[model samples]
Each structure stands twice: as structure tokens, then as C-alpha cells.
Target: MKKIILLLTATLLSTGVFAQVKTPQPSPTSKIEQVIGLTDVTVSYSRPSMRERTVFGSLVPFGKLWRTGANENTKITFSDDVKINGSDLKKGTYAIFTKPTKENWEVIFYSDVNNWGTPQKWDDAKVALKTTAKVGTLPMKVETFTIMFSDFKMDSAKLNFIWESTEAMLDIEVPSKKIAEESIQKTLAGPTANDYYQAAVFYKETGKIDMAKEYIDKAVTMRKEPAFWYHRQQSLIYAEMGNKEKAIEAAKKSLELAEKAGNADYVKMNKDSLKEWGS
Candidate 1:
């Protein structure tokens, strides 16, 4: 009989421990995974769709840190080195945290990737990135923290991380075209640097003039490149800055580069630009 009672007590204790623990919630809506270089990061969570109560202080409250996602910490997994808003993040998992407000917010990439909601695991040293709040018009209250890309370029893109109140923007670049251009200028400049013209094309199209200039100079310096490639790129930058004279000169250079390089296609393009300007 004593054995039976002891067994019953043991069983009850085991049940109690489990009863106090909560189970992980089933999958909900919204999922996003980003490849920062080679590593894969996943974000899976849900959000309440238009709660009956007012969502402000009464529900989510203000001036309080909220788990940006529906359950646990909004998770960010890094597969490779990431530069989040100029701050470097080593590969790892991190708990994403956000400070909510009516019109602004503070986002946190906490080091402690594992934790429950509300009071989170915040290791100061582990913070990989933190971004200042940005004010923008969001048409709807996003249920979960979400990231989307826009303004694409060869080496970088704008990542818009959005939630209630406001959103933040970060430059996501892989193998960093900025660095790549500098590398080319430093090591690849010489005759036929035009071979590296693809890198310059991306920089110019993406509105990175300083970067484009550095690379284009290398290409032009290559075997006295027809002013074509060099002049053309300069024109693009001048147009961007609304400088007509520099743009005209650049057009002339493009024609020269093309004729010298024996690329008839480029010369025709520059000729058209000059004709349009009646020059």
C-alpha cells in the first residue's frame, strides 16, 4: 500500500511539472527567410487581426517593449556575416525585440534568441544591431514583424522592416559592391579595366557615383580607353546631380571611348545623346 501511494505521488508530481509548462503554439500566418550571403534566416510568427479592443495602451500599451512577433521573441537567424545598418553581426540566432509607441519605435536585435514573451532575454554584449525609429505611413496594422525589399541593385538592396507605429530601413548588400569597386580600382586598374565594366555599370545604375567614378577611372585608364565608357559614366552621374555641362562633356567622352575601343554600339549611343542635346 505504501508503495502504491509513493508511486501515485510521483506520478502526480510529474504531471504537475508538465502542467505548469506551456506548449509551443501551432504555426500561424506570415513567414520570411533571408539569405545574408550564404546563411539562411527564418522568421515565423502570427499576429492578431484587428483585435476588438483599441490596440494602443489598452491592448499592446505604449512605452513598453513588446515581442514584435506573436509568440516568443521575434527571431532572426544569421547564416553569414551581416551588416545591419552599418553594424556587423556574426552568424547566430537572436531574439528580435521592439519598443512600441504611437508614432515611433525602437528595434532591438537581442543576443538572447531563446526566451518567452514580455520580459525578454537581453544580453547587452549580444546585441548585434539596433536601429533608430523611422516615421512612415503604414496603411494597416501589421500582425507580425515583416521585412520586404525594394530599390534593387547589383550588390545591395533596401530592406524595410515594418511594424506598428513606424518602420526601419537597412542596406542589405552581399559581397558588398562598394567594397568590390574599391578592390577593382586598387588591383584591377590598367588597360582593359573595361573588362571590369560590369561592376561600374551596376554602381552607376544604382546611383553610387563615387563608387562608379572610382571603378570607371580604372576602366578608362586601361589602355587609354575611348572616352566612351569613362565619359558616359560621368554623364550619368552629372545627370543625376542635374549638371548639364558635365553631362554633355561625359557624352563626348563616351563617343571617344567607343571609337577608340572599336565598340560601334557605344559610339552610336553617345552620338544619339549628343544629337539630343543639339551638340
Candidate 2:
């Protein structure tokens, strides 16, 4: 009987099914993410509730380094290089620590991303970027700590930190103008067959007949199997260049290809142009 009881206890322990206890946390973790132009910014932190306790100068002292969050170190990540408080900050995750005062808040971005609460020993060498932001007071009391993005634009946004009745903001800027200009230049310089064909149509409509002919010829040469629309545009370009013979010939080819490809619209277009040209 003793051996059987011991065997049953061992089997129950091996299976490892046990009851779990649920408890509420005083401070809860949260993740906030936002896209400012082409840059991705993510913040991970813990939010401690007011619980009717004084925060700014009492529980969280003034003129001293604070964890900026509860439990683990508050962290901020940047997907691309960004400008913070008018200074360049490279792309990486950093621990956020702050010193609050009545006038302004001193924000520090530390290189050491992994730490608990506050650093055991503060290291000036690990500081990546440091900046100051003016503190503002909220009209109503806030129950929970929150970080938010506001006042967004094409290349910039404001990162706001709110706890209790105090709020602080940091300006973040991304390289939008330079990226957009480079992309436009690259796409314009590498025109595809469709691009050339479209340009030809535009130039032909705008009365640049010589430039229209150049683009249409280039489009035809670049296409392995020119579509019915390409041939129709080519015929229109030839007609605008005062070459009626070549215009009629190109229209006939367009009509044949359109009919074979089952494009009724292009077929009708080519037929109308051909008839007008006395083909």
C-alpha cells in the first residue's frame, strides 16, 4: 500500500497539472507604436496608476533621475535614424531615463537597453542622446500614465508623456524631403515601355509632335510584344507628324491586334481613326 501511494504521487507530479492564482498588478506594461513619415517609432513601458497618491514631487521626486516607468527600464526604438530635440539620433533601441523639475524635464536616451528599474551605477558613457523638454500642466487629473504622438506632419511628430497633471513633449523629425526627391529622380530616369508610351500620348496631345514621335518609336522598340494600345498611340503620333501613309498602316496593325486580343474599345478606336484617315 505504501509503495502504491508513492507511485501515485510520483505520477501526479510528473503530469504537472496544478492550480494557478491570479493577481492584479499595481503597474501594467504597455507598448505604443507610431509611424512618422518613413520612420517607425516604438515605445515599451509600464504604467503605474495614480491610486490617489501624489506623483510628481512626492512618490516621484523632483530634480533626480527616475526610471520613467515601473518595473523594467522604459525603452524606445527607432527603425530609422531620426532627429530628436534638434539633434541627430541613430537607429536603435535605448533605455529612457528622465529628471523632472518645475521648469523643464531632462530626457536621457541611454545605449544600454537591458536593465531593471534603474541602473545599479549611472554611467555617463552609456548615454546616447540627451535633451530637455518644457513641462506643461493638464487641466484635469490623469488616472494612468500615457505616452502619445500628436501634431503630426509629413516629416515630424510630437511625442507626449503624460502622468498625473504634468505633460512633456519631444519633437521627432525624419528625413522625408531628401527621400522623396531621390525616389522621384530615380523613377523618372528609368522610364519603362509604358512610361514612354504614356509620355508620347501626352506630348502628342500638347502639340509637341516631334517629341511624341521620338517617344513612340522608343516605346515600340522596347516592347517584346507591343500591345494594341501602344500601336494606336503610335498611329496617332504618326498622324500628328503629317505622315498619313504611315498613320493608316499603323492603324490597320492596331485594329488587327485589338481584335485578336478581344479588346473591343481599342478595336473601335483604331477603326474610327482609320476611317477618318481615308484608309
Top TM-score prediction, candidate number = 2
Q: How does model 2 score by TM-score?
A: 0.63
lDDT of 2: 0.90
TM-score of each: 0.46, 0.63
lDDT of 1 at 23: 67
Model 1: lDDT of residue 100 = 65
True-structure RMSD, every candidate: 19.7, 13.0
Deviation from native of the Cα of residue 37 in model 1, angstroms:
6.6
The candidate that achieves the highest lDDT relative to the unseen native structure: 2
Which regions of candidate 2 are displaced past 4 Å? 1-19, 191-279
Candidate 1 deviation (Cα RMSD): 19.7
